[model samples]
Target: MELGYIVSGLFVGFVVGLTGVGGGSLMTPILIFGFGLSPLRAVGTDLLFAALTKIGGVWSHWHHHTIQWHIVGFLALGSIPSTLITLQILKTFQYHDQQLTYVINLILGIALILTALALSLKGWLINTIKANNSSKVVLIIRHLRSNQDFIMISTIVTGWVLGFIVTMSSIGAGALGSVALLYLYPNLYMNQLAATDIAHAVPLTIIAGLGHWHLGSVDTHILFNLLLGSLPGVFLGSRLSISIPDRAIQITLSTLLMLIGIKFIL
Candidate 1:
């Protein structure tokens, strides 16, 4: 691979570190749609790339005692079996590579739309949750709990669909999933919500990455290249996050996703 190719990895890593978004959403699409990598290779490599990065994040959360194991369990409950079904889906269609490209295009479109919406709606959601703070949200915050069965069933079903989509497209697991969780548990403490999402992300990405590996889709060299930049990128972004504004980051990410989506669609 050329040093320029690795530069894409570094740039993507820097953006991911700065915004905590767009690992698969931006990277895989750029690889396939911009750089013209095969969709199969892009998805596989990005899956492993996500897993590796999230492991580091999970460790940080664990050390801080910030990980919400309960929420993670709920998300895993939804995502794991779905991941298996996704693996099966990939197996059936692995030979029909062209269709996979179309799917990637479609997913790139959807991911962009969702990320844009998430970016705009996140501020609204946070504000609304704060302004119209209801007893239900307040109660949940005071107790910091969720109904057991609801969480489990939701998790499994959510995981199932996301698993299939993410495995097929390498999109949705980041901003989309986080946004979904935020809506479902509108009352959740934001920190706890982030912690839960990251915790959930670990297993979801790992399972999908392994499945891709089994299918011979993963490109380990590419994955390592992504990690080389993303790890340090996260640290660099943290240093700058305080100075940069959240709304600006969100808007920029949304716009980037939109542009990428339009490119894929057209």
Candidate 2:
């Protein structure tokens, strides 16, 4: 069983390296459906897994001067408070395991669906925002673009949503954050967007993970096995990412995630 968990982590980490999505997006689902972990336990375990895995990314991005500190700060301002509140809510329901499981599964399903849509639409959305089309969505984006204050507030609000969803589901801090940042800060380079998203996610996951730990949902032994496998997996996947057709991978991953989302909901 431990070896199975390690293998699962390796597979998930490889995919994450290739796709640059968050580990929680894949890991939590695998823990739930694949390994038969309770939803709350899966979420709790994955949150800490994500926090630990992403620390190196944050350091690398910081060294490369790719991270946007102001943006991270803005996101943290909203996400931190929201995380605390969400943790409190979870604590309140800790005794009701069935209800907690149901809520986590429902939210996880929704988050996965949203992440899938974000992955599918990201390219088209970015193009549409850049094009000189007179579409309503483009017009709204343009309006938001012109209003710096609104954009700043919107970033914070995006963080707030991510905080609540990620605390409950452990699935939104990466893909969803990137999509929102892409929409709000169209001028940002992809690296900058990714770096900023990761920078914010680390702290959010840590706080939430610790809260879940306090609630006794985390499995340290499972987490250790996963990390042991995932580190090398990520390295190998990243090395091979240069050779693969990213569009194909994204499409397949998006489809898989959508199906998983539907399964969770049903």
Candidate 3:
């Protein structure tokens, strides 16, 4: 069982390192279906795992100046509070002995389907947004921010919603969030978009992870073991991504997510 988790982490880590995608997407499912961990526990442990692993990626992006601090600030504005509220809700539900397993399964199923859609339509999504460029909306967002009005409030609210969803499912902050941001901030670069999303994700995951720890949903030992294997695997896999085609990787991962989604739904 232990070795199985380590191997799973190794594979997931490598893929994340290579493509910078599919860490929580793959790991949470493996923990639940492959190793038979509860969904609550799986998500809880994976949240912390993601936060820790992504630190390295964020640092790299920051060093490269790919992360747009303004966007990250906007995202964090909402995400921080949303995560806290979601954790509180989790706490309340657990206290009532609610069906954690069933709830987790439902959320996981939805997240997987969305992930599949995001992966499969990534190119179409990017092109569609670009084709329908909205300079007006860009100007509106910029002006609202510039004017120091309620846009900050709105951005935080948006972040809060996404943070709750991501904490529950480990699904967003990937292709889906990227797509939304592209539309909202048409002037943002792809690299900048990616970096900002990572920056937002780190804090959300940490709060969620801490909540899970309080709920006894995290397995510290397992988390450490998984990290031990994943860190190196991620490093090695990132090195290999250059040799692999991006489209092929996205397609394969999308197909995998689809299968998992359908399985859980049934």
Candidate 4:
């Protein structure tokens, strides 16, 4: 069972490296459906897994000077408070395992579906935002680009929403965060956007993960095995990413995630 957990982590880490998606999005679902863990436990365990795994990314990005600290601060300002509120809500239902499981499943299913859609539409969204046209979407994007205050406020609001969803489902801090940042800060480089998203996500996941631990949902043994396999897996996958076309991988992954989401919902 421990070996199985390690293999699962390796596979998930590989996919994450190839697609730049968050580990929680893939790992939590695998823990639930594949390993027969309860949804609450899966989410809690994966949150900690994500926080630990992403520390390396945060360090690398910091050294490269790609991270935007101010953006991370803005996101944290909203997410930290929202995460605390969410944790309190979870605490209220800690003893009602069945009900909490149902809630987590429902939210996780929705989050996965939304994540699939975000991955599928990412290219179109970027193109639409960049295109000089009279389309309503383009117009709104342009307006957002021109307004600094609106952008900042929107980032905070986005973070607030991400906090709640990520705490509940452990699935939105990567794909959704990147997409929202791209929309709000179109002029920023992709690396900078990714760096800022990851920097924000680390602390958010840490807080959420610790809250879940207090709720007694985390499995430290499984987390340790997963990390052992995932580190090397990420390295290998990143090396191979240069050889494979990411679009094809993203499309296939999106379809699979959508189906998984539907399965969970049903």
Candidate 1 structure lDDT:
0.75
Better of 1 and 3 by TM-score: 3
lDDT of 4 by residue, 1-266 (tens): 99999998899888888778848878988899889998888999999999998999999999999999988888988999999999999999888988888889999989999999999998998898889889887887797779889988998999999999999999999999999999988888999999999999999999999999999999999999999888888888888999999898998889988988888788
Model 3, position 189, has a per-residue lDDT of: 83
Instruction: Score residue 120 of candidate 3 by CA lDDT.
Output: 83
Among residues 3 or more apart in sequence or in different chains, the pairs in candidate 2 whose N, CA or C atoms overlap within 3 Å are none
TM-score of each: 0.88, 0.98, 0.88, 0.98
Residue 179 shift from truth in candidate 4, angstroms: 0.3
Shift in Å, residue 163, candidate 4: 0.6
RMSD of each: 3.3, 1.0, 3.2, 1.0
Candidate 4 weakest ten by summed lDDT: 16-25
lDDT of 2 by residue, 1-266 (tens): 99999998899889888889948878998998898999999999999999998999999999999999999988988999999999999999998988888888899999999999999999998899798989898898898799999988998899899999999999999999999999888899999999999999999999999999999999999999999889988998899999999899889989999999988898
Evaluated at residue 175, the lDDT of candidate 3 is 61
lDDT per residue as tens, model 1, 5-112 = 567777777787788878888788867866677878888888888888778778877887877687677667767887888788778888887897787677767766
Clash pairs of candidate 1?
A: 78-155, 78-156, 79-159, 82-160
lDDT of each: 0.75, 0.92, 0.80, 0.91
